[model samples]
Target: MKGLVYKGNNTVKLQEEPMPKVEAPTDAVIRMTKTTICGSDLHIQRGHVPTVPVGRILGHEGVGVIEEVGPSVKSFKKGDKVLITAISSCAACGYCRRGMNSHCHTGGWMLGNTLGGTQAEYVKVAHADSSLYALPAGVDEGALVMLSDIFPTGLECGVICSKVQPGSTVVIVGAGPVGLAALITSQLYSPSQIIVIDMDENRLSVARDLGAHHTINNASGVAEAAAAVLKLTDGIGCDSVIEAVGVPASFELCQKIIAPGGMLANVGVHGASASLHLEDLWHHNIGITMGLVDTVTVPMLLKLVAAKRLDPSKLITHRFKFADMEKAYATFGDAAKHKALKVLIEYD
Candidate 1:
């Protein structure tokens, strides 16, 4: 089997490794059909995620076919196509019961650290009954992979966390894949205004096509960007502001631009410390929530996809074979090519 191994900062390579097998009665093995390089993967490679170990496989978004199952695995079987959740979770935990699977107390994260991930020929899926979602037949693997992370993360942050209501004004502070996902998910709520802020013109254009009512280049200035956002809101700030970029500046901008009593949802992975002005937030009575998206949201997202409500095909801008994993990461990580929205690494 072939797998991607992160050796050090800015270093990743494909290497031959032993195939994974079901280690426990509740575990199952999957042969990956499609996987992707996430922005968070870049962070792990660049030493942004200090918790991730070197030489570990680094992918959390993937879809594949079940090749083998353990004795206790009842929900899945051989030949079943499935979408891998970003993290495996034991559904019996307190956190899992509340739908916060990402922070599950009983442990569920595989890949990149605990075990080899889906960025390979095969992966061992623990807690199979709770961790894998059966992919509907005829679904595009490239598009369906987004359900593992980017799409659901965006949907949770942009729609659910922000509590976006029809006719509400929403602002998203980034035009990256997550931001674009947020833009697409925001449409489900029928927000009156969807403003996207980013430094990249290409991404902003993509945001425009995805359904953002307006796009602002934050390079111009946060106040200037906020002014454009305000213009769309008829001189008031947006009712919901999503900090999709995760930096202090972007978070600050969201805090500054949100209307009083509004919701602020921070979706970006904060690699470093980001400060918040308590005084500024104290006067407004705003609600602030920031963290990783719950993997438990997969079932709801799957239902939407099954109902033909969410289509992420347009977000997959590039694809590469399993042999080209390193190159695919480089293309997706490069700041020069703003054209790569979501890079899908196909296994063939």
Candidate 2:
């Protein structure tokens, strides 16, 4: 077996590795079908996520087929096509009982740094019954790959956390895969207006096609961008704002554009310290919430995909083979940062 190993300081290498086996009673062995490089992966590669260990098999989002099941795994059997939830959880925990699987008492993401991840030919899935979702028959790998992370992440952060509703005005900062997924999912609420902000025009165009009512290239100045958004809202602020970039500037933009009493969902993973204007947020009475997205909403997202109400495939603009994992990393990690959206690393 081969996996992409993080070599540290913005480096990745493809190396032959031993295949994974069931390590726990609740574990399952998955044959990787489609795995992907996420913006978060870039964070780890760039040394932003210092917690990630060196030589770690680096990947989280995966769609695969169950090759073997542990003794206690009951919900799935070998040969079941499944989506690996990025966040690993013990479904029996108190937090999980409250639908906060990302914060399960057991752990989230037993793979990757903590263990071997889905970047290889096979991966050990911990708490399989709770973490893996069976994919619907006939769904292609391209469409379901993101369910493991990006899609569900966006839907949870952009749609659920923001509490988007019909006739509500919303602003989403960032146009990356997760941000674009947010753009698409935000439409489900039939929001009267959806504004997408990004420095990339290509991404903003995709956001527009995905149902954003307006798009802004926040390249010049924040005040200018905020003014444009304000004008669109008839001088009022948007009802909900989603900060998807995980950067200080984008998070501040979310706060700046939010309407009084609006809800602000910070979906980005902050890699560095970010300062906030507490006085402004306090005066506006804005509600702020942030979290690692749990897989609780995956079932609903799967239904939407099955019903054809949502199409996540539009964002997968690049593909790679497992053997070409190095190239995939280089392309996604650098070259395609601006041009490509989601890059899938395929396996048998």
Candidate 3:
């Protein structure tokens, strides 16, 4: 079977590899039908994730059909359509019991990180019953694939963690896929103001259409951007500032725009260290929080999608065949030039 594998030295390759089988009593093998690369994949390629070794499969989000199930599996079987989860968890673990599945002792974030991921013809999912979502009849697999990571990440980390309240002002720094995902989900809380900030005018335009009350481009400088944000909020900072871009500048911008007693929720996966201005922030009584998605909201999000309250498919701007995955990577990597949000890789 053909699989996209990380070959180290900031690269990936589509290579022929052996098919995966059940590795444990709790595992299941699924044939991938559709998948997409993530921002995190780019992070891995750029040597951001040191734990990922060479030759590891490069994805964790997708939709697939069960080809086989281990003896212990009961919620799904052969022929079931499933949504692959990026974060794997053993539901019975202590961390999982507390709704912190991202830190599950045996299975947190194994897929596409510490284990072979979904960017291939087949993938063996550990803790299969807990790590996969059963597709409802007539749901679009392409959109469901987005929920496997971006939506949950946005909803759980950005929206909920930041405690976005109705009638409050919120600012999201960065309009990339994850930032847009956070923009989309943040509306659930009915924030009176949603300021979408980025360096890309194209993404800022998309963010405007997606429900941002204001958009700021950092083309000049963060100082100018901060001035613009304060102008919108009547010279006061935002009630909540969500950092969706993991870079030092974006994070620092979040600090600059956040209001006193506000929340700063960071949803980006940082590959480098960022400084915290505690001297400036200490007197403000602000709350700063960061986390990996526990994905406990997947069920509710599924219902929202089924009801047409959410449409993740609108985020898809490109598509490629499984064989064109390397090309897909190139396009996704050059998002600003390609005007890409998410690229779906359709299998033969």
> Of models 1 and 2, which has the larger lDDT?
2
The 10-residue segment of model 1 with minimum total lDDT is 106-115
Candidate 2 vs candidate 3: the TM-score winner is 3
Candidate 1 similarity to native, TM-score:
0.96
Per-residue lDDT of candidate 3, residues 1-348 (tens digit)? 888999999899999988999979999999999999999999899887889999999898999999999999999999999998889999998999999999999988888889888999999999999999899778788999999999998888988888899998999998988889889988988999999999899999999999999899888988999999999999889998889988888888889888998999999877789999999999999999998989898998899898889999989999999999999999999999999999999997
Candidate 2 lDDT tens digits, 238-328? 9989889888888877777999878999999887777888977788877888898887889998888888888888988888888998888
Determine the backbone clash count of candidate 1. Answer: 1
- TM-score computed on alpha carbons, candidate 2: 0.97
lDDT, candidates in the order shown: 0.84, 0.85, 0.91
Ordered from best to worst TM-score, the candidate numbers read 3, 2, 1
lDDT of 2 at 170: 91
Top candidate by TM-score? 3
lDDT-based ranking: 3, 2, 1
Worst 10-residue lDDT window, candidate 3: 132-141
Point out where model 1 deviates above 4 Å: 335-338
